[model samples]
Target: MPIEVLPVRPSFVARVIGADLTALSPAATAAIGTAIDTYSVLIVPDQHLDDDHLLTLGKTFGDVEPPRNHRVVQRLKHAELADISNLDANNRLRAADDHRRLDSLGNRLWHSDASFREVPGALSMLFAHVVPPAGGETEFADLRAAYDALDAPMQARIEGLAVEHSIFHSRGQLGHTDYTDAERAALPPVLHPLVRVHPVSKRKTLYMGSHASHIVGWPMPDGRLLLRDLMEHATQREFVYRHAWRVGDLVIWDNRCTMHRGRSYDDATHPRDLRRVTTKDLSMLQPA
Candidate 1:
């Protein structure tokens, strides 16, 4: 069957169908890459991909990020994949007091994956192996549209500004501050442009998210206030797309141009497991 790209929103997201992700041809891979660049989010439904298959698909884009090494957090055995589940190492439901579960609560806040890192993430591909019966949707905000919607004056004001981002800052906001000194030292804050231009399409996008602590060189209180304001403007209902997940679904998004958050679910009662692989930005890999 020929591949099909169906738009899910007037701007930024699409549902890609008719291609088998497990065994994609070089031509198919190229087409999918083009589609992802054009539509920042691509939803491929009814795809039953194991961890191996998911990682293989991620490699087509760029180097997959190794699983984050949190000092006290336990991750899946494989270093390449991140487990986005509520289950413990034994595959049993985690206790309410579990640190892993507490850490994951940070996901409810809007964020672009790995934005706090020196080499920020480019793309994130998540495969839903199991889903709850209700309320586990992932919401994405269209930063590209958000940028276009800003007033000329507001755009001009932020043109040359940059922001400092840190995982500690974001998780601390959610009251999940159990990071050891070592862990905090390993993830020092990084600076990125407040407005970034897409490497391929050349479209500008608002790059601030929950990970963004404050604008660089600005007064702390004022920087935080401005960050809050921009976040509010960029996530207005008109620029958002909420994706309801299904088992066997794979959703890939461009982290560089969008912000996303996972909605609440009954994790204690319902099992919701999703595996994610993120690719590093190609620009970061290029030698100066």
Candidate 2:
């Protein structure tokens, strides 16, 4: 069957059908790439994708990086391919917002993948291994729209603004979000233009991550006030989409121009498992 791309909302997501990426024709593979460029989020339903298939789909874009800690593999799955959920050492389930010790990033505000690092991610693939009866919806905001929505004066004011993004500032000494000291050491603070240029589409996008602590060289209070104001304003309802999950639902999003956050899940009461993979194709975007 030919591929079908159905938009969930005119502005944001698309439900992709008619092609199996795990074993796609050359034309179909190219089609998925084009779909990614046009729609930031592509949802595939009832895809019983195994790790191999998942890896195949990710490689269609760029190098795959998996997270490093898991009972599933020895020495870890790298930092890019991670099973994103709250499962403890014993492999028991956890609550969404609850943090035990210094482990798991399930307790964050909002972020784009790896914006704190020198080379941020280009795409994110999340597969719903399991879903709870309620909760665990993921939310995404369209940054291009956010940038376009700002008033002219505000737009001009932030055109060249830069921010210091650091994971250290986010986790601190506790270091529980699964990165070891050595791993964390490998990642250092980086600067990102508040407004970035999309490489393929040649559009401007808002570039803010949870790891962004403050604007460079700005006073703390002033930075915090401005950052908070912009974040809240950009993430307003009109510019966002919330996705409810179902078993076998796979979500692929353009990390370059989207901001995503996890909604609360009934962690303590039920088990939810989601596998995530990240892609870093810097050629798709340029530093502003």
Candidate 3:
């Protein structure tokens, strides 16, 4: 059966109307794969999926990970995956600025989740459990649109340019109080093309990240200026899709061609909880 997927917003989000991803037929599964390429973001509502269901859904796409040393305590479900909840009373994160809330708060800067790693996440599926009264909106930028919007000259200039990305930059954004020095040192800088060709879709996309620290061998000031300008150009409001989440809303986005961010909610006043699972990326990053 062909699954019905309708657009939620103009640019990238779609709501799967009558499909259960955990128990999909081959044809329905194929439809979802096709839908993901077309929509980039998919929202399936009201289905309370357990760890097995989550893993099953992700398996239909690719590898499911709650990789070792995963930050949150996602066990009883899947420790390897991330469990994003503000009410983790026993969590080591006592400070208000922990990266533990990346799905709802820490991801304010546009980025492909885990893009700083050797194997970045290919997709992210977040299910809202308890949403705060206000704020904590998720923002997504259409990289393909951003790339297409570029002028011919600027496009040509960045065609062959590679940008350096690092986990260090993201970790240090709020100050590196979270990671030990060894953990930080393990993740070295790696370079990837400024523009990437999506392996499956063959679509051209601008690969820019707030965590992208520099251009290889380029002076710090120049690299910073270039990266900043490129990101600004790519993240114009015209190309973004902002999702003001409701409880039980599930958002799945293609990490291959979309950059996402999270707007902060007043964590001090109210608590929000969401479960986040990021599928692994096969596109390995190598040092320039």
Best by TM-score: 1
Query: What TM-score, to 2 decimals, does candidate 1 have?
Result: 0.96
Model 1 ranges with Cα > 4 A deviation: 69-77, 284-288
Tens-place lDDT per residue, model 3, 1-288, is 466889866657788877765687998878877878888998877767776777677777788655433454443366645666565546333356645544234466778877776677887888787788999888898998889888999889778777878766865665654666676687777777788887778788888787788877779899889888988987888888888888877788898899988787777767667677788877544322
> Could you tell me how far off, in angstroms, the CA of residue 101 lies in candidate 1 after the best superposition?
0.7
lDDT of 1 by residue, 1-288 (tens): 668999887668999989899999888888889999998999999887887898888887889987664533454545688888888777788888888888888888999999989898999999998889999899999999999999999999999798999998888998889988888898899988899888888898899899999998899999999999999998999989999998988999999889999999998998789999999986744543
Ranking by TM-score: 1, 3, 2
lDDT of 1: 0.88
Candidate 3's C-alpha lDDT?
Answer: 0.75
- Global Cα lDDT for candidate 2: 0.76
Q: Enumerate residue pairs that collide in model 2.
A: 65-80, 65-81, 66-78, 66-79, 66-80, 66-81, 67-81, 95-267, 102-176, 103-176
**In candidate 1, where is summed lDDT lowest over 10 consecutive residues?**
69-78
Cα error, candidate 3, residue 132 (Å): 1.2
Can you list the residue pairs that collide in candidate 1?
none
Order of quality (lDDT): 1, 2, 3
TM-score of 3: 0.88
Residue 37 in model 3: lDDT: 84
Q: CA lDDT, every prediction?
A: 0.88, 0.76, 0.75
